[model samples]
Target: MAFVNPEREEIKGLLEGNTTIAVVGLSDNPERTSHSVSQAMQQRGYRIIPVNPAAAGDILGEKSYPDLGSVPEPIGIVNVFRRSEFTPAIAREAVAIGAKILWLQLGVYSEEAAAIAQEGGLTVIMDRCIKVEDSILRPDIRRI
Candidate 1:
């Protein structure tokens, strides 16, 4: 069977309830989409946790973790910026860390990853941009 993302109300609920997001493959470079998206989310009051081996110390004013396992606090969402092929492994890790949501950025989708995350009891969203969703679903949130 094919995978389908949650409905608009469900996605809105996830965004409304979750505050902390772990951005996998987040890059420190301002030119990267991950950086910009995360920054936007942060401006809207979501805590962005940067997870990238290549980037340590701080990216976007938050400490960078090597992987999802190393994040000390509980993560609300695992927002993946990696390619489709890389998402399944990230799904597994997000499950292990008890993340409530698995969000694949626009243009990034994998049926295998969605299945894994859904089976692990996560709210899965694919081929969508969180920043765009937030702006659309929650118009009260100001865009920076």
Candidate 2:
């Protein structure tokens, strides 16, 4: 199979198409990158489901899940904010949970994880910030 290259257009399309985003490693602290990114996505009318083991309760007015398996509904996107070494596990869980997309945040990359997600037929994006993409590509979408 050809490589899954997430180009600018594909990233824009994913940002526009997916409405629910599960932010893995999202922190409760507003200062954290995950929180800021989730906030931005939430503002863009995307439901931000915080997925963090350390944070099990409510965050940003939404309940946090321990992992992808704990999320009750089908997630349109799994935006990971974890390290590259930890991405394979997240990718496995995301695939098992049937997430349509696997998004590794800026500064994170893992070829193995990308392969796993792609092998499962899930869209894979790495080393890019979703918030930046949304803001730059589709500014029409205002966050709530």
By TM-score, the best candidate is 1
- Return the TM-score for each candidate structure: 0.97, 0.94
Q: lDDT tens digits, residues 32-93, model 2?
A: 99998888788778899999989968998999999899999989999999999999999999
Q: Which candidate number would show the highest lDDT if scored against the true structure?
A: 1
Model 1, 1-144: lDDT tens digits are 898888999999999999899999999999999999999999999999999999979999999999999999999999999999999999999999999999999999999999999999998999999999999999998654
Worst 10 residues of 2 by lDDT: 1-10
Error of 2 at 3 (Å): 6.5
TM-score of 2: 0.94
Count clashing pairs, candidate 1: 0
CA shift at 103, candidate 1, in angstroms? 0.3
Show where candidate 2 strays beyond 4 Å: 1-4
Candidate 2: what lDDT? 0.90
